[model samples]
Target: MTRQPFPRLKASAAALLLFGMGALAPGAQAKEAAPLRPQVAAPLSSFDAEVNTFLAAYWRMFPDAAVAAGRYAEAARLPAPTEALRKQQLAFAEQWLQRLAGLNKNTGLSAAQAGDLLLLDNHLQALRWSLTELRSDRWDPTEYNVADPFAQLLNKPDFAPLPQRLKLMDQRLRQVPAYYQAALAKLSEPSPLHLKLAIEQNSGALSLFRDDIPRAIKQAGLKPAEAAAITAHNAKALSALEEFIAGLQKIEKAQAGAGRSFRLGKALFEQKFAYEIQASVDAQTLYQRALAEKEALLQRMSAYADQLWPQCLAGEAVPADRSDKIARVIAKLSERHVAPERFVEDIKAQIPALEKWVVEHDLLTLDPSRPLVVRETPTYMRGVAGASISAPGLMDPKGVTYYNVDPLDKYTPEQAESFLREYNHWVLQVLNIHEAIPGHYVQLLYSNKSPSKVKALFGNGAMVEGWAVYAERMMMESGWGAVDGKPSAEMGLMYAKWNLRVVSNAILDYSVHVLGMSEAEAMNLLQREAFQSHTEATEKWHRAQVSSTQLSSYFAGFSEILALREALKAKQGSDFKLKAFHEEFLSHGSAPVRMVQKLMLGQ
Candidate 1:
């Protein structure tokens, strides 16, 4: 370690040579055409028209996000896309994907070009899956109402003017009755678990909408007439939404006896697994990997404890009555440096410092275009972000990256300890690594600059998340921890904890859907096996049940990334620049690391 002098953060140029070889190759000259300068600009027209459309539609999906992320202006600009427009947009994507049919994956792409192709493929798969799910599975407005279209609009600041955003909400709400009706009429078979969990999550989240709409209107300071009209509009819309939920709840009982009765047939399940994850590995293979990783991480956890805290004993098999113990252990281990009231404030302070450190230390060459902000998850949808990043849109080369935090503000006073104990300072910093700087947001930001649509579209969960987890591990291994300078070992241990948790998330998904485990049984396993609080465990369990393919992404992606990083190190040998490798790695957006390795290793 001493002789290497490890250059705390320098990037590997070999990666650029490998991934962007065409640009770096003798006389290749083009991709490395020196970024946009004050006096000179890159020719925009040279980018494919379909690529431009890809960027535009990407922003259109979250118009509010585009505004908040500062990609586009709010006034007199493009309307937030309606559902119909979304379909048209998807159709365009389909056409764009087809237009590139015979093109070779490696024809002329810089690494970024290859990444974009991956995005094109994955996004095509995901978008198509979404459409199919809507037509066949439940398309209830409740989840969309709670999750993105409306919730994200309200959550991101300056997304749209109140009236316009309200109009968007009103439209979404107004359509609820019909969408619910459509869902009931068109759903070929009841997804007992999907319906059950989706409805519950929606109903739980609705309370926030109930609380926030008025505040939103009040903050806008519209005239009395404007307020009244908006109120009238929303009242009708809200009434319909309530009725829709009522119907969904009624439907819940309509299929009361069929709890967890749904099974995605082998073909559909296989298709979805492949499409959502971009992994050809079957569910069983994934399950096996998850099982192996879980045990492996458990063993690693034991080893770390043995080395660092020799007195502590972590069991090899399932422990009895250990939630309280784990919680206590995390708190005792974590409280040394965490200042809860000032968590966000501290994180904000660290961003520039980390940015300066990375640059000065010769970390990867990063895009100056992407700017990141650490913001508290709006009181409205913190539950969803729960320490996640709202990724940059493809259209906005320079996008505002949000590091969303779901503070446990609503928890009962008595439950405060449990609510936040999981978020001890070390874990929170590691989480920030996962969501913000050098993690998901960073990965996606560089990906946005990539030229290949398939890379972005077909983002493998394993790749995106694995890189993030790897980022955390990488930083810790290099003796960087606690944005405020603390022992990296604790952060490393906590990273291991979440690594275990990610594996647990995948296993629980397997248990619920494939092994036919009951919700109660699943909940117990989460608390016992994964060490999640009962409440947190229940919330995640619900998420896994409906967000089927998504649950596995965290662990699977992380594992793939780790393997890829090692392979890259081996391949590049003395030429491996950590910073360059990481920067070049992220430049392609999020794809299976195998694909990324091929693209970057000059395969």
Candidate 2:
């Protein structure tokens, strides 16, 4: 899973004016003022001005995001997730969306500005949909994961003198009680799963306060009195958080159906898929596409398994059943995994090898100066995904990016083995390619160089995830892990299995969220179809419930990006270069593929 920035609340005016007033007024007069000129003919400068105006307002509404994005002028503050703040954000979105709609699209916008317009429109629509339709603050207790903001503030060394940064953090720490209080007031009819997760996650936050905060305080070398004051505030906040978790546990005990339904159903799921993915197709189309891809991937895995069966089994008779053959071959290969204790270290070791391969293959350019640190996953962020890349935000260029891997030490022997088997040696390489190397870490590092901070701040998840999945395949296709300059069938088979996981991720997300697939069916899909272990499947089920449309991102993005590459290859013919294609694709920041394609191809 990709690590997302904490959600920032964007406030707006309480009252929504008529559509044709304010920013829309000038836009509405476009036809009358310049009757013959197309909106596309408008000066590029005008489009840039409009973009600036919109972003200025956006930063005002989401100062927390501004601060996170490295806009110190906005103030170092945490978002106020109060009901009034929600209403304000919704109103702001509606106003801007209408204003954007009123803009002349036929004359003035340059290709880049047009792309930005599409992105901004989708962003506003998504915000509105999230507030009105999803209403996460009301039912999803995980929305109150306060630890992320505080931790983010402390972790990044970008701000200033240690004391100044600590001062800002202390202010945020003091606000934590009110944040949780607002959360308590807003939340109602929460899902049991959400409540449980919130309790566990908040407990993790308490640990952060008890452990990491004190360490950070000492590291900063704050004055004793200042440190004592901060510690007092942190203690108070921790007590409030503990009290809140206890209250949630009490609610869980009292209510039979404690949590609200996690399902988005067909309609809401379609809307979310459209806006979140910004894809050309609808949810049903994407689901069908995923199903076909799953079948195709499984077939490919079966073909590889057929060839490897004799070798893997070491003269043991191959299973007669085709399904059994595939599963057996995978299990045999998984035996080559790292020990549980060495999992994180082993992952770290794979980085340089992958980087060397990328550079040797001339797959993409690398920036040596960008610092990427491999670390254990933070406690609050654990239990959702095994590994994730937490890249530096656009604003914090000097900040270190973390490749967080959840260690296997905490799991039972059986569970740990299952996790290990899922991330077997070969597959782990593919994962490192996806999460680091030429995937998120590299992609995000390039993104920070983008001139458009708007796109950087409001990145498209599909594009981000899709690029990573594409990187996995790209590395393999470029002859990665070839032994003695000869292609290894074992590596190829493992890569195919990893692709199966990607396909299965999309299928599981849609099935669970839209079709309401049961645990038994979901497990069968992951374990049997996707070749995942029981432990991996269980966590994926939880992830699918908590997140919608995200799991599908890898497939949706991979498909779109691949299609773009193929099209470019055909168009450019002999002139087509892989490295150029990769650089150009990522150059557009993390906008939706459609917009990126439009800008790149000049469509």
Per-model TM against the reference: 0.71, 0.91
Q: Tell me the deviation in Å of residue 564 in model 2.
A: 0.7
Give per-residue CA lDDT, model 1, range 1-603, as digits (tens).
000000100011100000111011112123222221122222434446556665566555434434333343421133322355446645754775675443323244444454454445444544555454423333322233323445545654555576667666655554445544544453334566656544655565555456667677778777888777766655665665566567667767876745434544455454555554544356678889888877777666655554444334344333343444444454457445544566567767777655655566566565666677777665434333356666544544444677766555656653555545566666666666666666766677776666554455334556766677787777666666654656645666677787777788778766666777787888777776666665667677666655555566666667777777788889889998888778778866555665666666665
C-alpha lDDT of candidate 1 relative to the true structure: 0.54
Question: For this target, which candidate reaches the highest TM-score against the unseen true structure?
Answer: 2
lDDT to native, each model: 0.54, 0.74
Could you tally the backbone clashes for each prediction? 32, 17
The most accurate candidate by lDDT is: 2
State in Å the error of residue 314, model 1.
16
Tens-digit lDDT track of model 2 for 220-302? 88779999998898788788788788878887888776468988787767666766665656667788898998778778878
Assess the local accuracy of residue 49 in candidate 2 as a C-alpha lDDT between 0 and 100.
Answer: 83
Error of 1 at 282 (Å): 3.7
